[model samples]
Target: MADIESEQAAAAAGSGALVLFSGGQDSSTCLAWALERFGTVETLGFDYGQRHRVELECRDALRQGLTDLNAGWAARLGPDHTVNLAALGEISNTALTRDVAIAMSEGGLPNTFVPGRNLIFLTFAATLAYRRGLKHIVAGMCETDYSGYPDCRDDTIKALQVALNLGMDRRFVLHTPLMWIDKAETWALTARLGGEPLVALIREQSHSCYLGDRSHHHEWGFGCGTCPACQLRAEGYRRFVAAAV
Candidate 1:
């Protein structure tokens, strides 16, 4: 099984990949993962009017930081693309898109759950990849240690991969490297990928706070330190640090 996976990874390394980068820790880690493997790597972000829209602002700096970490990454990194997905926000009544408090919805999910967000994102990513002639669409969607967003499940991604290929008549591989890994593992992966420098870059530049609060800096990063995103990141960083010690 390991040999087969290695062969698959080697085959994928020869192709170009489009990373769905949101300028958050997981997406940033996934971006580094793509840059290290794919022959060419491009980034695509969505401006969905998220309350944490500040994350979008972190994209360029993170990209530059990644490029600075390695000459090869700089050479392999391609153009960045941002699509205006403001319509998603208009339709979403969740806390992430509105001024509402973060709470559990009556549907047994968090109010931050943007319905069909990832599905729409993947569909649009597939469209962009098709136009860009890219063969791989990389995302940071993960099930482990997430906020119960159904769209982040591995099965959802796998099903969407089939739908996209069938609908587009193209062989587009959707890569979610963080699917099975927890947030602590994600931070550890970044350290392994580019060492402490990459880890520091992610901690400082990436924005994952639901409230868009960059005013307060935590050891993990800049956030409100209470939102689900921030809490998860902080706890993960604590674990990462403790494990390192």
Candidate 2:
């Protein structure tokens, strides 16, 4: 059968991957995948002045569990770590970083969209990758389940990849493991890579709650079930668990 177990282990030994981790469900899953696929796994998280401090909390919790970096990956590879792009956070006007009241929109970018957030994050990541000599930067962004966030789209990532290589002297590669996969498939991928218990930990321990509410459904991470992010998560988990049985 080629031993799927052995195959996964081999994948873990072959490469070095740096994840632009956000400590959310998607990014955490990507971190787990990187752990299993790369020999040297380092994570970079942003401490941008975002409205959701819960995101920071989740990042810390995942780092404690993963222990990938020496003392909290955020402190190491964050904006304060390699680059000094602190002004981006200060300048952003999006609801994610600002105190803007988010009103849901049916089309176009939502209030949660942080202008040029991913661009800045990825650009910084590419710089870090250049000095470290790492070839790949992994992210957990998804167009399938995300609100009309323009940066989460495939075209944006592809464009950024080209820009990174042209702007920086390094030939860097950007890998979005969850780009094409829907939320249910993401759950399955994490479960297959890290086992059911680990997957459950990701679902329960990680915070996806945009509203910062911990008392949501136990199926997924803590997010207000009413938010767009939470709605997708709840629906995805329901479909995932149902399909598993």
Candidate 3:
């Protein structure tokens, strides 16, 4: 994490960063991290026609919430970008895209894993950053505690950065604040970057459950707390809280 911290300090000290905001706990926290570190920060989201459009919809309310939390600081985060990836569902088939039970895929990976989703996401993020002359692109992808998505791995992102830079002939560094941290650390990150208000807001507002069930409430949020995503989030939150105590 020393390298990541150094890069983060540099990004914060330099121009600005563009974050891949998903309106979930991880991404929301990452947004705060970017805002705290970078001189200027922007956000982007993907409308990939997932099973639940709640995450996409939450992006706006989330941004407004950020502004509401710290108006003076939030305004510099820049305008939000929502790319139309509706056709992406045509190529990818998973519980995230279609109506399938939350189970495992053919290779024993989570059923919710949308093949190449991150690839497409980062590619678009890099392109957007490149055009905007932004050097850093931040994401909330985590490997320590996650849904078993391969694309979220650190190596995969590093490779993609290299490939994207080579293909576009531009230098765009991808920052993953939650790459090595678990969900618990993610919650801590939110607190560290945005304080208690942000931690509370994310716990109550961010939509992370794959089932899209917001009825059952917990310390971790409105997740069903059964889906793979929910389970990870709940466990992480529990651990984070326990450790803090």
| CA lDDT of each prediction against the hidden true structure | 0.95, 0.74, 0.85
Name the top TM-score candidate. Answer: 1
**Cα-lDDT of candidate 1:** 0.95
Candidate 3: residue 168 Cα off by (Å): 0.9
The residue ranges of model 3 lying beyond 4 angstroms of the native Cα positions read: 1-11
lDDT digits (tens) for residues 42-148 of candidate 1 = 99999999999999999999999999999999999999999999999999999999998999988899999999999999999999999999999999999998999
User: What are the candidates' C-alpha RMSDs?
Assistant: 1.5, 4.7, 2.7
Lowest summed lDDT over 10 consecutive residues: which window, candidate 3?
70-79
Rank by TM-score (best first) = 1, 3, 2
| Model 3 CA lDDT for position 97 | 89
Winner by lDDT: 1
Give candidate 2's error at residue 78 in angstroms. 14
Model 2 RMSD, rounded to 1 decimal: 4.7
Question: What's the true lDDT of residue 156 in model 1?
Answer: 97
